[model samples]
Target: MALTVELDIRNPSGLHARPAAVFVKAAAGFGSDIRVANLSTESPEVTAKSIIAVLGLGVQRGHRIRLRAEGADEADAMAALEGLVAAGLEEPLDEAPPAAPVA
Candidate 1:
């Protein structure tokens, strides 16, 4: 069976380098055949596990994309991806250094 879901791109930088990499990594963790299509741009659906293909979709902030997964783990894959998207693809920020040892 196939599971489909529509997700909004809320990442500030869109699906660029890091976010795309993260997305591809997440998609790869599942046994499902995952695909994503840019609804706003009407782009063709591409394998979600490919960073190049995901980047080729040209997805931008506020754009909606359709995620389709087919396999035994389709439901779990969809759920995980949906949560990731809802979280805005946030990565850990760089830590600040000590302020000159508070001299």
Candidate 2:
């Protein structure tokens, strides 16, 4: 069975560089075969485990992407991915400034 969900990109910088890498890593953790298609860009669906493919979709902030996972773990994979997307792909910025160097 395949589980599908539409996720909105919330990262300010979108799925580029680190964000793409993070997404690819998460997708790889599951046993399911995961694929993603960019709804906003109308790009072809690609395997979620491939960083190159995910980046190739040209997903940007506010863009909605469809995620489909097929396998025994499809539901769990979809849930995890959905949470990740909702939380935004980027790590929260550290608010504290660097300490001054010792003289």
Top candidate by lDDT: 1
For model 1, how does the per-residue alpha-carbon lDDT over 4-67 read when each residue is reduced to its tens digit? 9998787756799898898999999999999999999999899999999999998977789999
Candidate 2 weakest lDDT stretch, 10 residues: 90-99
lDDT of 2 by residue, 64-103 (tens): 9999999999999999888888777656533354458999
* Candidate 1 global TM-score: 0.85
Worst ten-residue run, lDDT, model 1? 90-99
In candidate 2, which residue pairs get closer than 3 Å at backbone N, Cα or C atoms, i.e. clash? Answer: none
Tell me model 1's lDDT, rounded to 2 decimals.
0.87
RMSD of 2: 7.0
Cα lDDT, model 1, residue 16: 91
Error of 1 at 16 (Å): 0.5
